[model samples]
Target: MTEKLNRFGMGASFVPAETLNEIDLGPLKQLVGEWESVVLTQTDEKGVSKPLASGWNVISVPGVPKFTFEVIPYKENLKFSTVAVHAGNRGPVLNGTQFDQEIFGLFYEQQIVSMCDTDFCNGRGFGKDTVIHAETGLLLYVSNINGGYNIARLGTIPHGNAILALGKSAQANNPGTDFFDVISALGVNLDGSIPAMLGYNDQISGIPQFAEFQQVHPNTFLKSTLDTIIGSGSVTDMTVLSMSTSHPDATGGILNIPFIQSNVTATSMDATFWIENISGGSEPEILQYSQTINLVFPSTGTVTPIIWPHITISTLKRMQPQPETNEPLTLSAQAQSNTPGVPQL
Candidate 1:
């Protein structure tokens, strides 16, 4: 029987295996299933420089898994904005956009992958990453938005979908001040532009464009769905890595974005798992987990790092597929198919 791991997080040390090159996946093996995040919050440390205030108060959808990870092909594409000049134009006019898929070309290989594709994190504002780690379990989930916003990648779009403005604009400060524009950024009209979330309510009310974590509609709380895996071991086993990289697409080809530069990385995972026990049941029957993701972006020549503190709460359940059958199934047996991920070989 497989031994169950109870917990895992930052501060744990790595013990090298006898095999020099082999790596153990740890509790991550049990993470290969569906889950749901019941509650979540994404915040930052802006108070030290300004006023103390709350951050994105959002949640995810349930049942229909919103977050997923798998053995996926690892690759990245690079895009550059091109322009067509008129007869005598010194400044370039419009032509079309050019893209280089896998600019840092990579061979097809399996990697732990995660992406924000539910209610939030979609195009121009999408978030996705392929993590790499040394033998010690240190990992970095690298990705650039149109470029990227590191901290909020898993929560809400930090600067919204305004990639052009992100690289050129300054970071916002505290509590509705000019320092940080959280409100105005979230307030953007459905069109994706904004005075931020705060200004959205003041300028336009009752419109779909004006929304927040508390209210997606008249009475509904717009929840962001999540299906994720948590590490199993001790709280000290896991940590965050904040990183950055350079590619034409990383900064959405924003003004003077470092067309070529060095990349730094920042990343870490905040997680908690619990087991519920009944008065007289079979060794604690239920397991659940809550995790917060800290993914930061590569900095542009002028822009500061974008941080995304993505969070999720999900219930855990094992869905073991029946053993593959060599013999043909009877009519009744064929009716109920086995769940996905069954061993076929």
Candidate 2:
């Protein structure tokens, strides 16, 4: 009995873990509950400050004169639920010893909507307050297995694509500095030069109010938001979770349906999430993430498939604390009896 409980991390003093206090969730615990996107401020050349939607998406599509580039600002709602507790995978036996790993997971749903009704270049973006994106997935916390990845994100998009990205995590005191460093190192350039190369300028995107956001690298918007938060000294610590399907150390990639695979293939995906802790504020915590997806499609002029990037970034605040779950793991004789040869567990 003692061994079985300890194996499952149910010690004598162990009590049911709630949303924010789950031991297996690690840094992902901060993500539980509801989150809503924020609105930042952007200053124009005219010295007038305008509202900048916290959610921004930039993508390129094949077009006539050149590829049509699009910049869309949106609002998002992300919610996480702790649906599983105490799962495991049994490894192969070697030299009379087998490796058994423990795992925990949380279910997440993401909904995004356009912030403006303006039309986009080549008729892409939706109208104001229109639902633009919907996604559901699982975030897993895997116990170490021979120095392998400890965290992973499994995402499914209605657009006929599924993503499996794996990586690691760490805590940092200076998230602003760390975020900037990683953004640069990961090839997410802040130069904002892709629009011109694609041939569609700000005027073509149709949202004149967001022209400034379109002119620079989409990440610049995220950097500015971090600067303001860190500059205010409100955030004291942060947990950085970075994952990539293309990372050499990790194993996983993107998959698409037949229709999507034939026209445009989603080759890879990478994302970084910053879970920040704020002191003495109405909102005790905030979550920010930057994600990039590589899309490859055949173009008429070039023999080589055109490689375009789809990037999305957002800053969200926690709406409320997640209610405590009374029993994360149920230990009952009736439950154990269902399985044959299983002792009282």
Q: How high is the CA lDDT of each candidate model?
A: 0.23, 0.65
TM-score of 2: 0.75
- lDDT, candidate 2, at 82: 50
Residue-level lDDT of model 2, residues 1-345, one tens digit each, is: 335656764332222344335466777777767798876777778999977788887665555654555566788988776554445667779899987776776777787776765654214435566566777778888866825787888888766788888988889874443454323211112243342234334334455346556424566777667666556556678898988888776579998988778866788888888888876543467788888787775444654565566778898988866566654322111111121111000
* TM-score for each candidate, following the candidate numbering: 0.24, 0.75
In model 2, residue pairs whose N, Cα or C atoms come closer than 3 Å (at least 3 residues apart or on different chains), thus clashing, are 117-128, 192-217
Best by TM-score: 2
Worst 10 residues of 2 by lDDT: 336-345
lDDT of 1 by residue, 1-345 (tens): 011111232122222222312322222222322222222333345534321111122211111121111111111111110110011112224466333211010111111122333333332122234121101111111222223432211111111211111111112121110111122111222233332323323312333321332222211221121111221211112112222222344432211113111221223343333332222322222234333333333222323333323343233233333343333212111111221211010
Please report how far candidate 1 places residue 317 from its true position, in Å.
Answer: 2.2
